[model samples]
Target: MNTLLTSLPKSTPLPRYATRLLGAALSATAYAVCLPWDLRNRAETAGAINETSPVTALGVTFLSLSLLSLAAYFGIRDRLSWTLLVVAAPPATLLYASLSSHPTQDANAWPVAWAFFTLVLGAGVLVAGSVARQFGPRAR
Candidate 1:
């Protein structure tokens, strides 16, 4: 039994770390939702809804959940999480940009850019977290 436990992957899964990942991912999601809200504020004045509203909401939700799922993946430090997050980010950005009501070309580009930034950051988190989990020590 001891030998079997010792042979397990170093990067098994840590519940505490997983919780932190979840919290951070959820926070990222909250930030995502705030993006459109901020944009909406800047576009006109008072809070308003447009065609992009649902898109923005959906984008925020997906990104948030993606991030959360990524964290959960990292809790296990699985390679697939890293892969999915890296791949899914760009399309999500496109979807986010398309949903935006930004006026100028440059302005419209910010949401996607921001999304990319967050995704990159999320990737970092996943990589680091996964590595830590992998290198972590075994119990006696």
Candidate 2:
């Protein structure tokens, strides 16, 4: 049993808070970049600036893939609390976008669908992380 264990590859453990920071940073960066495009697309569609395009769907897919991957990586190597930290990025960024976009307007200009999608995506991230943790290697 000892020899078998010795022959297996070892992975470096992530430091505490590493997952939290990395996950949040990745999520925030993704949202910062994608949200602007999403907003522009929505505004144009509403104003009839041009016909709608596939960019919106592509952006959403990209965000989903990237965020889910980040969550899974954290879940496989770190605790669940750290993985959950990723969920905070969406609302924080959304608030920033809202205030910056329309400080005087009483109504929010961003689409409500995205706010709802945040909840759904967050839950998906949690589930992905939880599932990954189940398959991760256990410490001795």
Candidate 3:
């Protein structure tokens, strides 16, 4: 008697689309939500975004590249660099978020809610990235 299940692969990958799109989207959204809010206050947003002032700006660029790499990763498996970029994005974005937000409003306010969403999305991407094995292309 065969006990094998055909639907499941030996690979323990996160859903490829979720990891690729969600990770990049979360990183972008987090930066979108937090960066402007901080800047609007006329504060030096960099101070709150972690690391040296110049480095935080660099991190923003890095996350943006990471997101683009996630798209690129979907198209080409030959380049190992895309994997690193996608993998690195969540933590870097989260680091910026954690440092940037000051919670000027009530805890339940829209800004706060949006910020929280960004955090959850960023963290979820990290969790998903750990397990993502890029499955869909094979299914096709």
Candidate 4:
């Protein structure tokens, strides 16, 4: 019995760092998938394109943010600091990608504005994650 116990393999959990990375990746992908809708809305607002369905755009935004929140929830787990990284990834990616396309000072402000908006959304993501940590399925 002692020899059998000694031969049993230990189960290894995923490293927190890896989970954080996975969360960031999922968050960024969610943003990337939804960016086109945002860009189209911007273009329509600028009169560079025809109008689009406000409902569709709103739905996309909600879906993307939901994805981000879930990513933060699962990725951050018990680590508060991980929330910062996971929350920032999507907006950082968007801001960086938009910088090269800023054709004028006025146009440049849009990205900054969007970044601020996303930052607010990111705060919500953090709250959602914290709430889930306290009450969701895996909650202790």
The residue-level lDDT of candidate 4 at 65 comes to: 66
In order, candidate lDDTs are 0.47, 0.60, 0.44, 0.55
TM-score of 1: 0.35
- Name the weakest run of 10 consecutive residues (lDDT summed) in model 1: 1-10
Give the number of the best model, judged by TM-score: 2
When sorted by lDDT, best at the front, the candidate numbers are 2, 4, 1, 3
Model 2, stretches more than 4 Å misplaced? 1-14, 37-55, 87-92, 95-100, 103-115
1-140 per-residue lDDT for model 1 (tens digits): 33322322243557434533554455445445534343443423355432234346666566555555444443443343543444344345544654464566433556667677657655655655465455534211
Judge candidate 1 at residue 128 and give its lDDT: 52
In Å, residue 59's CA in model 4 sits off its true spot by: 5.1
Clash pairs for candidate 2: none
Which prediction has more favorable TM-score, 1 or 3?
A: 1
Clashes of each: 3, 0, 0, 0
True-structure Cα RMSD, model 3:
11.8
Worst 10 residues of 2 by lDDT: 3-12
Which candidate wins on lDDT? 2
Clash pairs detected, candidate 3? none
Stretches of candidate 3 off by over 4 Å are 1-9, 12-57, 70-140
Q: lDDT, candidate 3, residue 75?
A: 28
lDDT of residue 77 for candidate 2: 62
- Candidate 4 stretches with Cα past 4 Å from truth are 1-14, 37-59, 68-72, 105-108, 136-139
Backbone collision tally, model 3: 0
